[model samples]
Target: MKAIVLGTLMAAVAATGATFSKSAEANELALSLCTYVQGDDTMRMRKKLRDSRVRVRDIYSGIQCNGQSLLQFAMSNGSQDIGEFIVGRLSVDELKSSGDYEWAQSNGHAGSPIAAAIKERAGL
Candidate 1:
């Protein structure tokens, strides 16, 4: 179901030359992730979180707005459920080793999924 929806979205976007948003810069998976974050589509994101097509590793580093991560972007955009969901799914090493994660860490962002979850939970 997730794959089908993603494929359809990809095909439709490609055919229409439509972009998910101005902030996505036409990145395929980024568009999906961004939308998944903002659209409250938890079902699709659960599958895509580990999907190679979504490139979770690569997305770790993309900073659409002032170096905010997908998780950060999502929660801020009012998708707390999705943010917490993905954060709970990912491991510390996976989040840390991703090229962008360390950068975000250095920049004072929560670089670990669990940590981010904690921070959000504490209302920090």
Candidate 2:
């Protein structure tokens, strides 16, 4: 009985550790994504997402860099290439609901190239 209990506890501990590991990996990926956007390294960002087998849309809502979404971050950083790339990957519904155009307009980025891309993508 003690052995069975110990085994169950061990399994639980292992599962918890795996969960934490996955969370850490996600955080690392988010940081890398933010860095790539900030640097406007669209190629590297694409490679990283492809290699990780993750799509931008899947993780878009989950990541916040400096209190801004990836698209917003890209626009703020003047990372037009990456911004367009991100905009391209997202779905029309996602783009429309993201309100990125309004955010950009209110944030003094209305004239940015990235804002134009957002408007085009969102069909705004």
Candidate 3:
């Protein structure tokens, strides 16, 4: 009985460790994605997402780069390619609900190409 209990505890600990490891990896990926956006490295960003087998649409809402959403961060950093890429990847409903267009207009990015992309994607 004691041996069985020990095995169970070990299994639980291993599972918990694996969960934390996955969470850490996710955080690292998020950081890398944000850095790529800030640097306007669309190719690397695409590669990272593809290699990780994660879609932008899946992770976009969960990622906040310096208190801004990925789209907002891209626009603020003048990352037009990445901004458009992200827009293309997201669904129309996601685009509309993201409020990115309004954020752009309010943040003085109304004239930016990214703002235009947001407007088009969001159908505003």
lDDT of each: 0.60, 0.93, 0.93
Candidate achieving higher lDDT, 1 or 3? 3
Query: Model 2: per-residue lDDT, tens digit, 8-40?
Result: 999999999999999999999999999999999
Tens digit of per-residue lDDT, candidate 3, span 99-124 = 88889889999998888887877778
How do the candidates rank by TM-score, highest first? 3, 2, 1
Cα RMSD (angstroms) for every candidate in the order listed: 11.7, 0.9, 0.9
Model 3 CA lDDT for position 91: 94
Clashing pairs in 2: none
| Model 2 residue 67 distance off true place after TM-score fit, in angstroms | 0.0
Ten consecutive residues with minimal summed lDDT in candidate 1?
Answer: 95-104
Better of 2 and 3 by TM-score: 3
Q: After best superposition, candidate 3 residue 54: deviation in angstroms?
A: 0.5
